[model samples]
Target: MKHFFIEELLPKAGGSVYRLTRMAARRALELSEGRPSLMRKPSSDKVTTIALEEIAEGRIVYNKEASSVSSKDSTSPRAVLMRGNLASSQEKASVS
Candidate 1:
């Protein structure tokens, strides 16, 4: 298989090669451990390739904000626990 070049994947990963590489590795590890893929049409591609494609296609997003959030006090609104799906669900419930 023709592997993806770094250039092709960089922009999708917020133009940070290091971040792309890190997230792709993490995602690839998840795949290797039998995590379900986010893609609709699954190919026989390797885990790493699938991961890079997922990032490129926006199926996965890098969480650069997580680090900053973690550094803040837990009570802060931007804390890690306040930024994920649960927080969004709570917001929706309040707005309804």
Candidate 2:
């Protein structure tokens, strides 16, 4: 079992704990429904734990669009990286 602090997770959900809970719940449900985990080796077999690990590790990107159904729009789920929201993956990993 891992301990997840609110401070570590708040920004991932746009600083809203409610959204965090909602997002986590939704991801957890997907895992329970047999969705494959994004993690190479999930921390646990438990669906909820796997979901949280995904979120914590930045494997899950938050869909900013208010309307969940947005295939016609942006905000695609199951994306590995959200360019606008975080540091570019291509940027050199050197601390300045």
Candidate 3:
């Protein structure tokens, strides 16, 4: 089973994203299994409910590093070199 944050669900429901009220969060937790609740106060009047699963842990990895690479003259020479090596290796393998 996958846990979803209430705020995450809002986009899926096509509703305005807002913090889930404690009442709302509690209700959702009560109805669901094995999911933890995260509460956030976004404003004086509104408290947002974010589920633990909805929050990103920290970093994200993408397989296509080329999209993230900047320009030919990027500061990270090692990364660029590695990408070029991989591309060249692929081309050579494909040609063979």
At residue 11, candidate 1 shows an lDDT of 79
lDDT of 2 at 16: 84
Best by TM-score: 2
Among all windows of ten consecutive residues in candidate 3, which has the lowest summed lDDT?
A: 54-63
Model 1 worst lDDT window (10 residues): 67-76
For every candidate structure, what is the RMSD over all alpha carbons to the true structure, in angstroms? Answer: 13.1, 13.3, 15.8
List the global CA lDDT of all models. 0.62, 0.65, 0.32
Residue 19 error, candidate 3, Å: 33
Each prediction's TM-score versus the true structure: 0.60, 0.67, 0.18
State which candidate has the highest lDDT: 2
User: Runs in model 2 with CA error above 4 Å?
Assistant: 65-96
- TM-score for candidate 3, please give it: 0.18
Collision count of model 2 = 0
Cα lDDT for residue 12, candidate 3: 29
lDDT of 1 by residue, 1-96 (tens): 746778877876668877677767776776787776777665646888887777766667654556221212335332222123557789999999
Over the full model, what C-alpha lDDT does candidate 3 score relative to the true structure?
0.32
- Ranking under TM-score, best-scoring first? 2, 1, 3
